[model samples]
Target: MFPNLELVKMVADIENPTLFSHDLKSADILFLDLIVSGGNINTLADFIADIPILIITSAISRWQYPEFIKNREHFALQKPISLQMFQSCIEKAIQP
Candidate 1:
């Protein structure tokens, strides 16, 4: 658990367009926990267009995910990742 990291937002529903867009835009990193299929990519891409996304999963690598999402612009962080590693990832991701 990253006690030092401050979570700007965390949303469960992707359908609430107004709130979802607002929350995502305000966050530095997006922690998405879903297996994105072909049909789901377009809408999601729209909302997460400019944000850095971290796909949290128990899988070993991005290869385990669908080809569409794996090849897209995003990072995969295996579950049970350490606090130090998670913090390191956040730091690297937010850098300009």
Candidate 2:
């Protein structure tokens, strides 16, 4: 779908999340799964401060991450994501 985009997948080792870090400074966007990161969203959010992020979480209603909520560049998508919603979020995130 995103023909011009380059996607890189990284599996975070929950036991050692920091072990897989590799020059993410140049990445245009970040797709993160909150549950899989061992609830270390803040740390990862801070690391990619300037980049736009699409966060996936099962507990959408209970989410209280003010930092992400307040940022226009950050988007949260609930579990069982739909293609239309995903596409909309991607478009919004990439908008200037």
lDDT of each: 0.62, 0.61
* Candidate 2, pairs of clashing residues: none
Q: Distance from true position, residue 11, model 2, in Å? A: 1.7
lDDT assessment of candidate 1:
0.62
| Model 1 regions more than 4 Å off | 1-5, 35-42, 52-60, 64-68
What would the per-residue lDDT of candidate 1 be over residues 1-96, giving only the tens digit for each residue?
655467787655555456558777766667776644333534576676666555454445665655546656666568777777667777766667
lDDT per residue for candidate 2 within 1-96, as digits (tens), equals: 877557775766444435544545666777766565445556565556665455554454544554654464466777778888878877877777
lDDT of 2: 0.61
Instruction: Give the C-alpha miss distance for residue 90 in model 1, angstroms.
Output: 2.0
Deviating ranges (above 4 Å) for candidate 2: 37-39, 66-72
